[model samples]
Target: MHDDLIPFNKPFFVGKELFNIAQAVLNGTIAGDGEFTRRCQAWLEQHLGTPKALLTHSCTAALEMSAILAGVGPGDEVIMPSFTFVSTANAFVLRGATPVFVDIRPDTLNIDERQVAEAITAKTKAIVAVHYAGQPCAMNALREIARNHGLMLIEDAAQAILSGDRGSSLGTLGDLGCLSFHETKNVISGEGGALLINNPELIERAEIIWQKGTNRKAFMRGETSKYTWVDIGSSFLPSELTAAFLYAQLEHAKRINSHRRTLYLKYFELLAPLAEQGHIKLPALAQDKPANAHLFYILCRDANERQALIAHLDSAGISAVFHYVPLHDSPAGFRYARAHGKLQVTTEIANTLLRLPMFSEMTTAEIRRVCGEIDVFFKITSKQPCELS
Candidate 1:
């Protein structure tokens, strides 16, 4: 093993990143939506095949823009899974809409499509489907429900960039989609995101919302002499420096994805036996869906067992961590869902799920070492006696 502990997620940077950022700075336009931003936007549109896109400071900003564009407001209800990053719900909640929490599928851990329909109400405005850990949700089922209810479908593809299924991109399947380039994601610009406007009608309004509520973009296009505030908006656009950094990542998207996929599969192959032995449960892949292999996680018997495994890994100088304590039990989400109902699966998985280290830079040797340590932990604690080689 290496001298230093393996961090959970290490952002990989190519040689061109700093150079591009320097160019952005030296070009005298470090502000948002400059040359680099335009380049990045063009790259996204080409890669994702979305009709339009607007770069934002973060995924949360992209989501906030989606809420505004969707006309979500007070008295409106948005259906989404409770087992997600708070930003998923917070974006809609900030717009004064109540989030109707749904349970997750125990297999893939993505939002339950069946439960989503039952959660829909007359006030439902949108359905935010989070592509949990780079796995695509059941978009077809969700789409049917959304169409039946006449609600907007928003894809929170924060962890699912470059992930999709059935000829549909993860984010592009919905009315609007959001992508994150956070340090933790497969791609990194330190902190940045983009909103994918699949609908042509939403493009103009999406731009207006991104440019701080003004028609400045149209003005610059020679459509108008002057621009003014025409809608509720905020400063959501990201600087050219961030876009420049992201462009480097986007340029190497295939390479980065290939490396991450290698590591993801390595973990799965090494840990499958332990799962079969009843030591831990590995995340199940859906046969019908395609995924980006963004994360590799296992569910322990309970919270205590999960904690013990984490401690064991730590003792061996490996760093492993748990993720998302089901939003229904979270302080803010619980308060918001006071009148909704209980989230049984959400609460249960929150305690059992433990995310393993996954990054594009991780070497196969390092993955084997990490899996070996986990195997040792399970053997020492399992019903069967430990047999050290």
Candidate 2:
């Protein structure tokens, strides 16, 4: 199986990851808030058009920070999709706020905008819009809903660093946005994230929270004579080494994104037959927006077919996998949150979805191999004896 193995995801290198890490070390400030960290933050703020961007240890940390900034306390409720990473819900759950799980759109797999409006209650404090697979959620609809309901809009743009909707960047469309640089992302630094503060009023307090509840950022800027704890927070800043690697990757982001997009288009071309023949369903790109090629997945006819297809891929020395289970049915989710309505689409996608091998470094041959394996699976299954017929 190890021979000619194609992993579901392979980390891409832009040819400067290590050299920049070395430079960060030699600069003698490898901890945090060093030159590299500042540069990374500045680049994100300028690129994303956010008032403030603070690098964090992880997207989860950034979400936790947003929970704090949003003033989500006990009895307050936060609405989000049930088909997202746990960090999206856990961030607010940790603050004693209830996460109201909702269904996602079938095409974009993003939170349903109409459902969001219906799910809001008197106790609701915020709405966390998770841009599933880098396809942005309906931000205009969500923003209008938030404004009408007096709820804060937060963007969980973990997989949407270089993506945008309509004309605005994903991270700048909400009151607060979180970005991840995990190895699986378009641009990565192994395990890094950033908090995008769109609301200018939250910038000062965000810096305080990012600096471990202290005024260290202001102190470093000579605006404050002494730095001291002023709010509740944890050590969220990432090391300068992480920032250095991130900066290097960001420098070549255009090339990396372009390469990945080509692979995505190739997948679409290769798999169009399966889709047209009703053997599988492919993701539908947003018509008015742009994606960053974060992932490529297909939906089998049912859970059984999905499992069989995965087995076929595995036997062929390929790695394919399913995504998140519905959060409403999860143990932690049951204990920490409530379901808004029947998660029909969410549950269906969870069972039928299969993520194929996709990476910037992946070649056309690998994509063909994966697509061929799918064709082979259906061909074999078609010849199998029906148990009940």
Candidate 3:
């Protein structure tokens, strides 16, 4: 990679990260669920207002834990959008459940709540609402639907830390919510995640599952005489080093998100003229749903245009990319998942969406350089200059 290249994502450190790791080492516990892990979990619980928060190695682990807590088994169907990361479907599919792919709203690129109701059947056991680009889905409507159908509502909040719908936090609104702290996210710990448990009934089991299927937590709390393997689980907890690194990031999360939102708005402001002229389409976030500004993206005229734009950016030493080949169209999806409807919107968005370079420490000048390249691309392709006013 060139030194001048503006990479798609960059991990940042606020303060006290290495110091905390050294402290964890001095405190003599670097294993999972140690001092640093407890601090990180407590911070998540307090900030998100969730009843319980358990740190995991990655968001994939969190999703897997939720799948088990939901009791989804073979022949049980889980509903989610196809325009999401594979972990959203793979978690349940690993437990022998079939993922039912659903369409997304054209505006937010989130799961279409209206389509969710139609997809429900006697075999449908859960609904996974992935908050795309840190934007909240129609949670009120989704919650009502989940209640009416007696199905579990799980939130794939991988990109939505500190985001909110109405007055409630995104991850706390559902029975189970998963968050990612991957390096690409607004707040990161290299690679880490957490599962938020809102339902009181699932708390005990979630703790057990987080501890590799033992009552070890209870034993530690002096609530039991001894710990033993009592249920099915895996080593989901992250080491104290990861937790210590994450706690430092969590301390400055609000400031980090604030800076990223500023960068997000800068991109929108610079590119709005092209959008107004129909050269591209800017993101449309709902008024009541404030996001964490996890990423900034644009919709090109078509897949061809998007590819060309990505190549143009790469040539200019900027890294722009696309993702998720519409899981329903992938091979594993063919075997473990099924589409619920036409999914016209999902397919369309998948073709045109392109994510630009975004990071918490990104500068306004960098954003301008990226948008300028976009403008140049359109000018070259369309044979005309777009009005920048």
Candidate 4:
């Protein structure tokens, strides 16, 4: 990669991350569930209004824990969008559950709630809502469907931290929610995640699952005489060093999200003319459902145009990229998952979608440069040129 290139993402620090790591080392408890971990969990619970939040090594671990808590096993099926990351389906697949992949909405590129309803059967155990690009999914509709069918509702909110729908945090709306603090996310923890428990009944078991199936958390609180393996689980919790780094990011989450939102809007504003001219499709935005601006992506006319745009941006020393390939079409998807419908929308979006450079520390000038390059690309390709204002 070129030194001056505006890469797709760049991890940033906003607070005393190194200082906190040093403190964790001095405290002599660098393992999981240490003081730093407690602080991070408490911060999430307090902000999201969830009853409990348990930090984990990655969003994948959180999803795996949610699958176990939902009692999903062999013969059970989990409904989710085919446009999402592999972890969304892998968690349930690991538990011997079949992933029932569904199509996404053409506008938001999120799981279509209607498709989810149609995919349900007697064997269906849960519905996983992945908030793509930090935009909230149709949570109200999804919740209603889950309630009517008596199934677990899990939010794979890896890209959604401060994002909300109708005034409620994305992760807190479902029975269980998963968050990612990966470097690419608005909050930087190098590699970490958290699981938010909304259903009060799942709290106790969730804690046990987070602690490697042991009652160590209760023992630490002086509630248990001894701790031992009591249920099915794994080492899902992240170490104190990771938690310490995350706590710093969590402290400045609002500021980070705000800056990223500003950048997101800038891209939208600069590229609106092209969208109006039908050169591209911008991501759908809603007032009531505010996003954390975790990512900003646009859909070109087709896969060929997307590839051309990426190459054009690269030539200008700006790095842009494409998102996920539909999981339903992958080799593992063929082996472990099944599609509910034609999934035409998923395939189309997967082929055309291109994610531009977006990060907390990204500057408005950088966004303009990226947008300007995109304008040039369209001008060279099309007979009618659209100017970037």
Best by lDDT: 3
Q: Please provide, for model 2 over 1-389, each residue's C-alpha lDDT reduced to its tens digit, 9 standing for 90 to 100.
A: 46899998888678788999999989988998899999999999888888889999999999999999999999999999999999999999999999999999888999999888888899999999999989989999999999998899999999997898777899899999999999989899899999999999999999999988998988989998997998887899999989999999998887888888888888899998878777888889777323888899998878898888898899999999999988899999889999998899999899889999888789989999999988888888873322210
Clash-forming residue pairs, model 4: none
Give candidate 2 misplaced runs (Cα > 4 Å). 288-290, 383-389
- Residue 181 alpha-carbon offset, candidate 4, angstroms: 0.4
Clashing pairs in 3: none
Residue 377 error, candidate 3, Å: 1.0
Root-mean-square deviation per candidate: 3.0, 2.6, 2.3, 2.4
User: How many times do residue backbones clash in model 3?
Assistant: 0
* TM-scores of all predicted structures: 0.96, 0.97, 0.97, 0.97
After aligning candidate 1 to the native by TM-score, how far in Å is the CA of 212 from where it should be? 0.5
- Arranged by lDDT, best first: 3, 4, 2, 1
lDDT of 1 by residue, 1-389 (tens): 54868888887776589999899999999999899999988988888889998899999999999999989889998988888898988898898998888888887788889788778788999999999988888999998998888999999999998887777778999999999999989888999999999988899989998998999999999998888999889999998889989998889987788778878878888988987777777777767332677788888878888899899998888889999977777789766753245667777789889998888788998899899999888778755522211
Superposition error at 276 for model 2 (Å): 0.8
Better of 2 and 3 by lDDT: 3
Q: How close is candidate 2 to the true structure, as a TM-score?
A: 0.97
lDDT of 2 at 124: 97
Candidate 4 regions with alpha-carbon error over 4 angstroms: 1-3, 288-290, 383-389
Please give, for residues 63-182, the per-residue lDDT of candidate 3 as tens digits.
999999999999999999999999999999999999999999998999999899999999999999999998999999999999999999999999999999878899999999999999
lDDT of 3: 0.92
